[model samples]
Target chain A: MLKFSKSHEWVKEDAAIATIGITDYAQKQLGDIVFIELPQPGAKLQKSEQLGTIESTKTASELYVPLSGEIVEVNSDLVDNPQWINESPYDKGWLVKLKITNHSELNSLMDESTYRELIAKESH
Target chain B: MESRKTPLYQKHLQNKGRIIDFAGWALPLDYGSMLKEAKQVRLNCGLFDASHMGEIEIKGKGAFKFLQKLTPNDISLIAPGQMQYNLFLNTSGGIIDDFMCYYCDESLLCVVNSSNKDKVVSWLRDNKEQGVELIDKSEETALISIQGPSSSRVIARVFGEKIASLDYMFFTKKEIDHRQVLISRSGYTGEDGFEIYIESKDAPYFWDRLIQEGEGFGLISCGLGSRDILRIEAGYPLYGHEINEETNPYEASLGWAVKSNKDFIAKEEIVGIKNKGLKKIRVGFIMDEKALARQGYGLYLGRNKIGEVCSGTFSPNLNKFIGMAYVLSEYAATGKTIEIQIRKKFYKAKIAKYPFVKINTKSKKEV
Candidate 1:
């Protein structure tokens, strides 16, 4: 099942592992991605903590952890090919694989419909 | 206060430009990818609606002398049809603003940076001598630019060969759609281009004509995002970033703009600063890492902080991250290495000479 955060991060859960990446809406707003800094594997992160940073040609934006978890793996390929995030924010562009530390934290995230409504109001 | 929209506002929407509030003016940041737009300028042509830029007219016989006192550059060096880059320096040797003046023989037309219009106008009036009529025409005038290598070809297709070959820095008055428009062979980008001044009421028509005729030559509309990157790539100093009220001309590596023979504002102070040397010196640097060294970032030599970055960006032409930084005079030298502190980590960068890309401007002498 897919869950989302208000900060534009998306998470797809399978058993206890959740795949995380930014939304297409977020990537579009950023315009272009030039470079990125990802977190190391096995790092313990809490809910709403800064996870990584993405740099566009214009400016840099920090990515925040949507839920508490221990990072299992990160997409290291994005370090050399950051533009891939802009090209595919959902599939190959997945940022980190996290083992959910708190199952109740997933309840705080929004569904697809709720995330769509949030962005729709932001455009106005 | 509400943000002011340029006369080309609707046209920007029609072209699908991503609008942003820049210096209280609603303008296009980019259409989509600023990198793509920047790359296009190097290969072909690009259009820009610069209507938000400020224009001022100095009338009467006192105009020439007023210009002499206002700027550090020698006005007499330029001919009637030519223009020169200039700086408005205060008595303390600080740069109040940077502007360009077109020598019109009868009167001089000055284009000031948009954000500094109010300040520049007040300064001009405060120092107003007799017989000089300082008229601010910024509200009525609109600026449109065609930039890049293919600029001349697109201009030739519409404005004809005579206008296309007008040489760098020179301009001519032409009647377009029964309205008088001023076309100058100049631009912020180092590439060959033309900056056209038209009436605000006629900007849309002017933009449409250029975009339509330019289509055959691969000219696309560009935004301020790419413009900034292009100027920095060419090593041009921006008013707020590389220059400001605190930084003096000599410290900014703009000593060439100051005339030794002519008397102008802050001439004495600038000459003193040049002879006494400066504490800080501005230099351009290319990053050795993928990380960007942004403005206000600290520069380091070993463990000591030496200076700060003023402007930073990724150059599509160079295919690397680059920026301009001000460092201690002792540490500032070409080929010297410095570390930029980003995210609490130090990344190495090499100081290099700029106009990072080869200048493509065609001068009158070259013609």
Candidate 2:
């Protein structure tokens, strides 16, 4: 199942583990990604809480967790080559892999179609 | 209150520009990506709609004399058809605004910051002399800047050979597409370019024509986002960030604009401050970490709170985070290490000389 947070982070769930990254719209809005401060593996996070920071040429934005979980893995490649987020946000730009603790927290996030509609409304 | 839109608002909307509220004006933050636009300005050419900037005309028999008294720079340094970077100082020797004063023979044209337009007008009016007339031309005037290394080639292609001979800080009046405009060889990007001032009504058409003609020359439309980054890379100071009513010219490293011999506003205080030397001074620094240092972030030398960042950005050219801060004079030397407290964590940084990227303009020697 694929879900997105209001803050523009997307999560792709496989079994109880989910991979998290910013949406294409979010990367586009942020411009060229220069630096990203990611939470380390084993770090605990709450739903909608600031998990990390993403810095672009213009501004810096806080990255929010879509669901409450413990970080299983982080994309360490982003530290030296942050532009991967801009070049291939969906694939190589995955920020973290989290082992979801609360399955009910997933209900709060919007599904793919709903997130598309939200972004559509926002663009207008 | 609703923000006023520039005449090119529709064009920006059509070009996929992300509109944002900037100093009570609706302006594009960028057309696509600020990083791309900033790179384009450095490598090729970029078009900028600077219509939101304010222009005030001071005309009369005592126009030159009144300007001499108003600005910190020596007004006599620039002749007709030339412009000089100047500062408007308050009674307390603080910066009111930094402007470009254009000497147009009979009248002096003052190009000021959009955010400080109303305040500048009021201040000028209050200090009005008997013969000088202060007229706000901001609403009627529109400014368009074509900036980059290839800017001269693009401008020469459209406007003709006349612009080719125009040196930096020089301006000339010309008619383009049946509209009379003032073309000045000046820009904020620290690049070779031209700033064209035209009537607001002619702006849309002129913008379209430039974009259409400049397409062959690889000129792309840029926005304020890239402009800010470009200026920061060039080590140029913005009004509210590097200077304000509380910050004096000496501390801002703008002492060159103040003519010590001239009898201007806050002359004695400014001269005294210059003689006494600055306690704190503005310096550029590069962060050791990839994380960005932002404005208002505190700068510290160990545990001592020395100063704070004024302007900060991730430089596209340098591929590093660089920023300007007003630090204690003792720690202002190049290569000095400092720490910037960003989001509760202190990041190591070093004071460095700027322009972080080498300036490649036609008048590089002059700068």
Candidate 3:
């Protein structure tokens, strides 16, 4: 199942492991990702805490964790070529894989349908 | 406060430009990808709507004399049809605004930053003497710029052979689409480009016509995001970032615009500041880490904060993080090591000379 945070990060949960990345809407808003600082594997993260940082040509933004977890795997490819985040934010651009420790925290995040509606309202 | 829209606001929306409130004006932050737009200006061509910029006209018998007393540059040196970059300074040698002055024989045109329009106009009017008339033409005029290596060809296609031969820093009045307009060979991007000043009503038409004709040459619409990056790469300073009412031209490395022999506002003070040397000077740097340094970020040597960054970005062309900062004179030398505090981390960096990207501007003088 897919879930999203109000801050624009998306996650896909397969059992206890969740794959995460920024949404397409967030990538479009950021405009041309040049660099991304990804959290290292084994780092413990709290729900809604800063996970990493993403930089475009003009500005930089902090990436936030959607749920409390420990980073299991990080996409190191982004360090050399961050444009993948802009080209394929959901698939090839997945930032990290996390071992979910607080399963109830997922309840606070929006589902795909709710996230779509939120973006639609933001555009208006 | 509500933000005012420019004449091309609708067109920007039509093109899917990301609009943002910039200094009371609703302008495009980017038209899709800001990096792509910035690269277009470096390799191909980019079009920009600069209508938000303010234009002030000074005329009458004492117009020339009045301007000589207004700006720090030697305005008398520029003949009619020539333009000079200048700074409007306060009595203490601080810059109020940096502007371009165009000499039109009978009158002078001053192009200033959009945010400083009211402040500049009021300053000019307050200092107005007998025989000088000041007219604000910002609302009635629209400014457009075609910038890049291919800009000359694009402009030549729309105008004529005359535009191809124009020298840098010179302008001429021409009739385009049956309306009188001022075309100048200058731009904020450190590329060979032309700035077109026309009637506000004709802006939409003018922009559309250029895009249509320049399509063959790869001309694309750019926004403020790309504009900022290009200027930063070129070592050009923005008003609020690199200069302000408290920042003097000397500290900003704009001493060339101040003529020591000329008598103008803050002449005595500025001359003294020059002789005393700058306490802090602006310098460019490339961060060793991947992180981008931003304005107001502290610059440090060990634990001591020496200065602060004014403008910064991840350079698209250089493929690295670069920025400009005002640091103490002792730490302003090329290759001088420094650190920038981004968030809680301090990234290693080194001072370097500006124009981080090589400038490709045309330097041919008119015979």
Candidate 4:
């Protein structure tokens, strides 16, 4: 399952586990990514809960969890190479993996087309 | 009110510059990737359209005397063809604006912030002496600033080798397309650069010429976003950030520009403030954590609020998070550990000297 949140985070689910990262639009708005701080693994979080922080050359903003889950792993190598998020935000730039706690939560999120329409309107 | 567009608006759009409303003017925020543009300037060169900056020409025989009363700096220090950094202060010793004053044709050309243009013009009018005249030439003039390490080569290609050899802090006249123009060896980016003045109608032509000539030199069109980072890295004061109506020059660490021997607005109050002491002073800091600290964020020593962050950014050249803040003078020493409140958390940072990255501007020796 692939879905996105209104706050511009994208989540990809596979076998009850989901990987997440910020949308390309969010990265562009933030200018250049410099530092990122993610939550430690094994931490439980609810849908739309605070996830971590993403700092850029322009300013700092908070990352949010798209759906309820428990943090299983984080991209630790990002600490020394934060610009990877700016370079390859979708693939290698994935922020963390979370074990799904509520599968139904994905139904409430927007699919690729709906999210695309939302961003198109929002940008204009 | 409609946002005013500069003469080069079409050029900006053609270059894919992201336009933003800045103080009632439409200006470029970035072409793309502020970091890449900033890094390009550090590594090569970048062309900037600074037409939003105001140029107020102080003309007439009494201009020198009028300026002596208007600015904190000793206006007598500069002569024709030379320039000096200056500040405009109010009666309470508050900084009204910081600008570059160039001496030419027995007049002073003060390049001031776009946001403070009206205020500076009104102040000059209200205090005009009998023989002095103030001409606000901002609307008719276009300022194109080419800055960075390779700026000399690019400028020389556009103008002549004579312009490339112009001494730092000096300006000379040139004729481009039969239009009288001015080129100065001065800029705000803390790099080897030139600021060219030409008729507003001729700006687009020159912009294209520079871009064409700058292709081999790796010059990119930069905007306000990179301009902010570069100034912050240089520890230069923005009108409302490091300086304001409440900030005296001494607090902003700009006393070097103030000449105490002369009589000027707020002179007595400024001297008194220096003699008594300053409560807070501006200092630069490096963040120990990768987190960012923004303007208005609190600076703490233990549990007490010691100061406030003025300007903050991630320096591409240094690969470090750096910022400037006004803190209590007692705790302003370099290497002193402090904490910057970034939202709900506090991150460690330490006081450091400015020009966080070594500056590459041409010095007198380079001239």
Best by lDDT: 3
> What's model 1's lDDT at A52?
90
Please give the interface root mean square deviation for model 3, in Å. 1.6
TM-score for the A-chain in each candidate structure:
0.97, 0.96, 0.97, 0.97
Residue B284 miss distance in model 2 (angstroms) = 0.6
lDDT (Cα, tens digit) per residue for candidate 3, span A81-106 = 89999999999899999999999888
Q: Model 2: runs farther than 4 Å from truth?
A: B364-367
Per-residue error (Å), model 3, residue B190: 0.8
Model 4 lDDT per residue over B1-367, tens place: 9889999999999888888898999988888778788888888989899998999999999999899888889878777898899999999999989999988886889999999999999999999989898999999999999889999999888898998998888899879778778999878788889999988998998999999999999999999889888888888889888999999999999999999889898999999999999999999999998877889999999999999999898887777888899999999999999999988899999999997877777773311
Better of 3 and 4 by TM-score: 3
Candidates 1 and 4, the one with greater lDDT: 1
Whole-model lDDT per candidate = 0.90, 0.90, 0.91, 0.89
Docking class of 2: medium
Question: Which candidate should be chosen as best, given DockQ against the real structure?
Answer: 1
**Candidate 4 residue lDDT tens string, A39-118:** 99999999889898888876778899998989999999899988888888888889999999999999988999999999
TM-score of each: 0.97, 0.96, 0.97, 0.97
Q: What residue pairs clash in candidate 4, if any at all?
A: none
- For model 4 the local lDDT of residue A70 reads 93
Q: What DockQ values do the models have?
A: 0.80, 0.79, 0.77, 0.76
Roughly what TM-score does model 3 have, to 2 decimal places? 0.97
